[model samples]
Target: MEQAFGLVHHGTATVGGRSGITANTICCDVCIVGAGPAGLAAALRLADLGRDICVVAPLPGDGNRRWESLTPGAWKILDALGLGTALAQSHCLLSHAASVSWGDREVNRDGHAEVTFLIDRARFDACLMDAARRRGVRLLTPAVASRPQKIGDAWLLPVTTDQTTVSLCAAHVIDASGRKALTGSRRHRLSPATLALCARWRGPPAPPGVTRIEATAESWCWSASLADGAHYAAVFVDPRSLRAARDEPATAFLAAVGRSSPRWDGTLASPVTACDASASRIARAPGLEDTIAAGEAALSLDPLSSQGIQRALVDGQQSAIVVNTLIVHPERRRIAVAFHAERQAEASRRDSAMCHGLYREQATTYQSPFWSRYCGQDTPVEHQLRSPVPLDNLLPETRLRLSPRARLEDTAVIDGDLIALAPALVHPELDRPVAFLAGRSIGSLLARAFSGASAASLFDGWRADSLPEGTALELLRWFWQRGLLVDSSATDAS
Candidate 1:
């Protein structure tokens, strides 16, 4: 690792004309501040591109167990890394069912289709770090990139360890530092406060073909049987609403588990651990100083979706591409940054809305401050979904206006507060939701589409990226139902 960084010793250093410690300065292509899953994944990919990489992180220990499951989307990355056999050898458990306990009844969403995997987060991460190391990733663990500085087009990071501090210089910086970004930039929290307490267990095989999800009076629980004859149980609750022994989280975890529906119960036998499993409140920010934050550092999803690991792996991949573009093709940096920002913002909205919907569905009858506050917002997932709209029934004299609450771009989602969409003229030559239409926002486009144009005339020349006759109407219906596209006269009358 030292050889890769081109380490050089400066025998003596003086500061303020006082005694100072020795220093070593090294240079690399890219420097990663976090060595967890996100950092390692990015390092592996960056190395594949033949980039010199240096990673500064704390040594992985018991903390890795906090990440236990991987949604199926992660398989592609594992396969690409040739870790499919390693993953298979790791005794990863496959779960076919995604069931939820809404109120008192249990509902299985997947009907037992194979999808999610339960693996040892500790082992999986260790394997990833090992793979990255083998690929020439210089890891300096038990070290901190606590502060990084930008000197011209390069980044200078100060890494501190027990023995000495090392200086790392790189052309680009990747902040895979999870939520506590090394840059100390704060993220916005979208949902009401929530956290998870998870514990491991050894138990009998769970019911075939399903992972059980349960919602209780004050919290939610998820228990999955692992491939290696073990099980994992996690409980989600608002810390304020929970008044349990902070020192004995295992007992609190057990008590919460006991309250869940009994369909997939397992005996709790391992020590419990608590961690923040909240969806990232921080929306993906525009690229700054060529530094990119990936995974939880970029956007943390709700655990209810169980897609964090997969998202992290994918985020790392995307971050690598972004970093590569910035270094290899500086002219394309603007395009790459825009794409990353849009993708991340969309993911954040999806996670927020899905979580809101999941909690809202469970709280329809039961009334509790815990659920009420988080589920109180309107979720736009159902609204964003494509459904049939009847543009054929439009009145020639009818006019439309963008809803006061609508915001648009090329890609759109229901943010907690307003509807977000991207405006683009659908054309036959374009891909789905194709190229950015300059100066287009949802409101302006909708206003122009129906402005003084007859219903037949509006539909006559419309070519929105290969929409079947009925599909276009459905898109309009989705917006109309949500009041994103409203009748001008009707709105004025009201």
Candidate 2:
């Protein structure tokens, strides 16, 4: 290994195998702060795009030992990141069952069992960072980066390593650092400030292959059996509840657990720990100034959602595309920034509503501050379960016209791995911006909907696009269901 400014360079692993240094200044295409899953994922994707990237942060596996439930969604993301095999080989606990006690005293079993895996977060982080390093991602470990300044088109980050400071410059920076992010200008708290008090224990594992989730007046608790013949439990509560009992947090923690559920009590194995579990998001645009925040840095969701690692990996993948777009097409900077910001906001809103919905269910049973504060006030976007206008019953000659609320707008969309501006059909009634339906451009069809179009004529006209025989009608039904299409007779009657 060659050492440059205290950075060890593995042979054949250089930026082609040398520290990216010139006159003591390290320069790269992107600089990622924080070596967590988010930062490492961004580094891997950026490397795939042929961009020289460097990750600066302290050594991995340094955070408090915490466990995460890796749902099937998280598994898919890990597979995309090429860590699926690694996860399968790891000593993760394969849970076959999970039960929830919310809204009422009855325990409800999850329908989908045998897929979720409980994993040690420290081990997972090590695996991801190792994969990134092997992919030729430059890592400046045991390092700390000061505030970065945008000089010209590059960000100058002062990194301190081995008690010495070195200037690392890059065209863009990724703040994957956790809640206390180093880049995002502001954080918007979506719910009440909450704290999660967790305790790790070693004892006769609570029945094998089962995870328990319950809610009570004091807090909500989650406890599960571990692969190491041990078990762990966590209770989430308002931070204010701990002010008086600050001197002996373990006592308060155990009391909260007992109130939540009797199954969580166990022999204490590690010091009780507390972490922020509130829902929040970056107030500023995600890709503003070419500096993007990923993972917890961009959006932090409540642990009740069981989506922490999943959200972090998703933010990592999306931020990579944003950075790649800004580099490949600087002219499309506005489009890229808009895409990132919109996506971040959309995820925040959706997850926030889902988590709040869960809390809302329990609030019916436990009318406490913890539940009341999380009971979501904002409504989620409505979704249609059944089509209002049935295409099967409509005659071929049925005349349909576009709803006045529907229009075409240019929007930035994910084109493969990059952001591209495309004309998407937008409507006040549509759940999401629709660019295409069943491989057919909604724009081309909507443009013809200006005047009333017969169902037969529309299908025949769009058949040239080679859509399957019934697909065109199905696409029309999609619009009709969303109120983007209205019957010509209804228009005449009104």
Candidate 3:
């Protein structure tokens, strides 16, 4: 039998019910919820690892008609998943740079630096789902999976499809459900809460792969020509700011685009859609270690970053590796879970910080309440608003241990130029935290040793076997907060 969706499938089931793929009550190695890129890519990856996979999702994904731009980095991840070349050959618009208008400055960013593609999310997701189905992954659609319940070391998910219910039992479950995690995950919006009002347009022939971004006194706007030959424009605004626009969402969004740039003038059209564009993350919780949340289900990136889709593709692959490894080496389950958590958290923090930094650059010129809020400044009425990064989450007395899941490498640091230690889980964005650790070189020591050594002991060791000082402890706390270090006592490895 051919693997569905062009996936490289292994031979058929050698174990009864293990490789089972059907609609009725089924048993499988893994059951994945959500069939977007992350979830579908994961299903393909896990199937390659020889795991029987079942995916439940609504096809077409709301026709996700808004134009989505894909970066070169995102393609690398898809290439590894066998979708990159297919996507490249599919209906897509290719461009090299974006027109960015921030504050009073407008320029073409990274002109000729990278190949970016503008795609329709619906077609993109459909392509991925088709790939997963061909790869031996059982496709269950129009089926809504209820919250998974852990039963006797397996997950029992009740899937409802076409007025029929199927009980699926799998050893592992992956929640790729966007924003509100389907596996009962909780999300806290990190950035100033904002909504995106979007509309599809047909006029003057949309630019080929060129994405336009403009920042105004009240909010920001983005416009791009999708592969479908439709131009899409979206306006992002704080609810209060959108209210100040004094009109309905579609009207306000059109008004925002009207003055956003010369290219977007009078080109707005109908079939508008709006969604929450706020940066959010799954809260650090106990049972989170039991399952993995990939893509938006784990952490939602900032639109201003221009790397959200890239991050999701990479995240989807990384999550699959972690899950596959854990299933093979059950003994390293703790380390694998820690790896997923820390990397996801680090990514979330960096995305938030980067967006704040970008906003700060524009705040100098605009200084409106909306821009001011993003810059960590507050109006009289918005007194509690502050920078998105909550660095105080880590406590001094917390008992931390080297995460067995961290990747070790010799990397440059801000403090000492270069150091041999495990760098921040997310590079470039959270490198400073590791640079601070390089000042003490604690990461180097931890790399050489650490069989679950306590953070306090590590600090004492940093202090030459004497009482721990506050500076090293503070730096280590950054690692703990970012997932490089895990709580020694909280994790019940036994």
Candidate 4:
């Protein structure tokens, strides 16, 4: 066996079956649906933890030719997955800047601050799938898996390939099958339904190393050059806007692209692909008794955040941990499920809030239906949005207390490679259950601060509690910014 990227090569994948509950059934510790980023990431992590992982993948070359710009942060996660050399070999294009024209402002960002890469999503996903296979994951390629049915303690998934159909019986299932998911029902719509019209171009060249994003009156458009020298442009708009030109999707795509950036017109290399770009989440808890939904199967965010792949990769790792806990420590199964559910909800809320805020800002500059729809009052935020109290307003003699809308709760959190219960500070403005910040426990910090103590007294107490020099003031600012801490006087006045 050859070793590549720290993975043991099992030569080539064969179309055979592994013995499961029955002789003909394929059995494993975990059955992962979809071979995209999330599923593959989970497969690799689960395999690392000494679990048998079976990944159901589409046939080779069966992915969309979408182009995505990977931030430096996203690249770090991919690199950790042993894709550094693979991506370089795939000729991923590195860019040093981006051009944005939005909200009455046009700015060019230089890569001196941070660099990014434009990658073909199809090739990127293939690289991840290959990496997972090399790491000893059993892959059912050229296969489609149906929704899993519970049988006894295992979930049985029916997989169909070109040759035959087989049953994959596993102790747990991780669903990462993208929008048309194989598992998990009851989805909650986060943003208004929107569609993306995308196509590849080969005629004209864009800036050598720049990605252009421009906002139009009724839609937003972006274009970037791929590693293979082809240019890609996409326009996102309301689905209803395209009903009139239903038969001419390509024409509507070109027209929409021209409205924002007219210079991007070029010879089409592929037909216009219209995909749902709306933000949504699985309303039901992602982790159930023996199944979990990772990546887009759990929560899909608006493309405006440019975090689709990043979130998928992160969820993969988290889901693996939750699954491991459910199987290894069955007594904590509920905690693991609730932890993953809360995390997904937190992600949905944070991403939706950011997207809505941006749309509202853009709507102020361009009065269009596209922007107006997101500015409405369908936000998922827990409580009414309130401005943060200024930290400078807190005097040394001023007393402080927790915000009325926030509280400390015993939350399930990730400890090492398992889910554990811990004290977390929860607030409507917060993205997740925050248990620690700046190496200090949130519960202890709050306990010392909420004792009717003055600002100076809190600071002195925190320092006495072994917080570093100037750490007390920084912690105070952090709380004030998140609206986790408020003035006692203000509460009394109200």
Candidate 5:
């Protein structure tokens, strides 16, 4: 390895099978911070392009496990990079519709949709790192990087480890450090809108279809059987809710779940062995400079979107394309701008629609006094109807107008009084509920309920009555009327 890089080791020590010397510094074309999905993906892409790439991440034995979502496209990228086998063996596929219920009625009014995968984040990340190593990407573990400094035409990075402090220089630096850490100008720091609480369980395999059920007062919670033979469930709640539960105990949280949705009964009864949680949201101003951000660093998606992993994979691929293009043709910076703009527009549309629905639901439930005050029935429809603002617009001042109870920081929302308004404004696109039943006809509304009643008990009260073929078509028509799904028949004919 030293010979390939034309380096001489000073001592009789070996590292990653290479006899190394005393030098602690290194240099490469690209220095990627954070070894999570985004960083690993970037390194692999650069390596494939034959560029020298160096990746720094917290060491494997460092005992800090990162959390991540693994989508279908992300899995495909891993397969292309020769890590698919490892991922397939270590992650869980979520193959069912998710919903929320106040009583017997489903909050999301839709029927059924596509599913995503839930992964054992630590194992999955390790697989990606290993794949990068096999492809000649230099790997540095147990390292923490300070804010990157721009020096002349290159980037200077200082990293600290147990042994010593090391400095490396690179042409460009990619910030994939996620939300906990970031580099570049602090122009666009937005407070987080919500806090999430997650936990894992060991139980019987989840039913064929995995569903995530969320309530208004309680945070978004999900459960799925993992590929590694374990069950997992997590809740994303308001910080106030977490605080309230902190003193009460597990039963209080579980009781909150029971009030929101019937699905929690099974999980509440199961023995929970592990709990993991965090708060997340997009950067408000993402600043201006030659540097670009991707994944959580670029924009944090609501976990309810279930598109977290999909967005990361897409961002990684698109960012690589943008970087390579800029390297070869410095004049076409517009290409990168256009790329980011298109994505921004798409994300804006989705965020606005989802937040609107969530807010409306909260208003209806009157889950807590906090929610009731901000989402009071008398709140103006215009405020509720306001276009889903880009995360940038959801700043402290803006959020205050939406909800008077929130506390905002430069980068995180320390208090979540305002986020209560999020449920009121959640978009209809996101709130629509879906279910999958294996039958041919729409039977009696009650009978349909019985066909799949057993499973319905697992989720909210979803019944599996058969629908007449024509009725099924009408249901699709209703969904189209509501703007949930597109009618592509015309486009297909064209």
Candidate 6:
């Protein structure tokens, strides 16, 4: 079987004939729109499977610019695509925890979370494009795929660019055009309480040991030092508080933050850069005939959870799997439909709960029109506005454990009674034992025991007293670092 892919550049041609341009023509088994991480990932994965893939995107230019932050999962996906090391060297790894404070109470606290990265969107997109090119995926830049048409069982895409128009035929089309280019009538609108403004800045070296500091009032303010010593800060505000600053954007938002906490004073400086902030709900149609949507085009979640990047990668990878399956089996289209439906439902549940919770929390403190509209003195109003579903309901079902499930005894005999038992465990009464008499790392021991080697054979020559004092602790730490072990209480059980 053969496949083809195409990428149309953004802003190269107006699809509505405003630019007096004709459509270009091409043919491929699969045509992917958008060249961001998701689209590029789909292209690369499909190409690796020996399918014809075409990637379309806007030509490298100043008009099509984007700036956003990527969470930890983004790095993982990039690495999987062979760009991880380069991105790690270039982007700033956010190491600090994120705190949300309101009044005297801290509503939320995330600790030791290192899954976020702040990056320049242009550079990141370029990197993906280069990777896709090197992997044999066809690329079409400075091109735009206009209204899609149905021709028998296939789809015909009319693409346009500055100098020419082209027609591309494909059995399937994946839309990664994002929200701005969505062709569906259904729309996801964010709550009025959600708003964000961000900009880049060059400032004095960030205060040592300070990675990110956030303050919450009617909204929240986040400040962090980039890898290059530059600082980037964003203020998320409610619509009401934002209106109060109609005449002065940065000043009003900064003042709101300053009034909530004095710490922001040091971070908010003159010549502060700013950008307009907007929020939207997540919405999508599972599959429109032969056309499928992925990435931001299919669904958008609240940025509060910082799950945007992760979801994009997941969607990209899942979409690739779906397309490949459909190409091979042809009869399993229903499975792909069901998969997307489940994804949309989960995204909707999560986005709604997150935005509502944030809006309500802020509303309780600030007595502004925005807060009042969303959250007021009415107990029923507040309670009714509460999230319909719990946050845990959004997590995907995976086999990875957050904590070790098995317990090791001080000493126990293995198969055949060939191994001897000893009970010299210190602090045996505590939930976590400080030391084990066994002279070996528990993880290493577990690895050996699970490797088809009998416990007796492996431990027969082991010397309990020869083990170092911190060997077990070191092993546990290693397990934690590798995500092989989890703290039971870190996540909700259900």
Quick one: best TM-score, which candidate?
A: 2
Which candidate number would show the highest lDDT if scored against the true structure?
Answer: 4
Point out where model 2 deviates above 4 Å. Answer: 1-23, 61-63, 110-114, 207-209, 283-290, 376-387, 390-397, 438-440, 444-476, 492-494
Q: After the best TM-score superposition of candidate 6, give how far the Cα of residue 300 lies from its true spot, in angstroms.
A: 1.1
Every model's TM-score = 0.72, 0.86, 0.71, 0.82, 0.61, 0.63
**Evaluation by TM-score, superior candidate among 2 and 5:** 2
Supply every candidate's count of residue pairs whose N, Cα or C atoms clash at under 3 angstroms. Answer: 11, 2, 8, 0, 44, 32
- Local accuracy of candidate 2 as per-residue lDDT tens digits, 1-494: 11543543223222323433343467688999998878888898999888988999665443348887888888888898788887776667778778788887666565466578888877777788788887888888888887786666677788888756677778889989888788777777877888888877765555555788888897878877876667777878788878856636687777886675555656788888888888888654444446888888888877877888887888898899999998888898898988888877777777777877777778888888778876645646435344465556466787878777777888888787789977888876665788767765667777666678887777787787687778876776767676677777775333
Local distance difference test, per candidate? 0.66, 0.76, 0.68, 0.78, 0.52, 0.56
What lDDT would candidate 2 get against the real structure? 0.76
* Residue range with the least summed lDDT across 10 consecutive positions in model 6: 412-421
Reference-based TM-score, model 1: 0.72
Could you report the Cα RMSD, in angstroms, for every candidate shown? 7.8, 4.6, 11.7, 5.4, 16.8, 13.3
Residue range 1-494, candidate 5, lDDT tens digits: 23344432333433323443234456677888888777888788878887888877865543223344556676677677677676766645556544455323564423365445656577777778888888999876778887765666666677776666666566767777776546644423222345544444455554533555655454445665555555456655555655665734354445555564444555543433223222233442343255656666666665655666667766665666566655665566664545554564456446545644555566576566534433432321222322432333221121111111112112111011110001111224432112212232112222322232321221222212344555544443332343322222223221
Writing each residue's lDDT as its tens digit, candidate 6 over 1-494 gives 01133343333333322342333445577889888767887888788878898877855543313345676666777787677766655444554545456534664435565546666677777777877888888888867777566666566677676666766667777777776544444665544435665544455565322344354445566656655565566666665554665646666655655665554544543344444344343344434555667777777666556677677776776677677766876776775656565665566565556656666766666666655554442222121222222323222222223234444445321211112233322221222322232444443445443343322333332324354436544443343343333333356442
For candidate 1, the 10 contiguous residues with the lowest summed lDDT are 412-421
Candidate 4 — which residues are off by over 4 angstroms?
1-23, 60-64, 80-86, 283-290, 381-407, 427-432, 443-473, 476-494
Candidate 4 structure quality by residue, lDDT tens digits, 396-445: 88788888888888889887789988789988787567987777678888
**What digit string (tens of lDDT, one per residue) describes model 3 on residues 127-186?**
888778778888878678888766667776777777567676778888887886876545
Query: How well does model 1 score by local distance difference test?
Result: 0.66
Give the local distance difference test score of model 3: 0.68
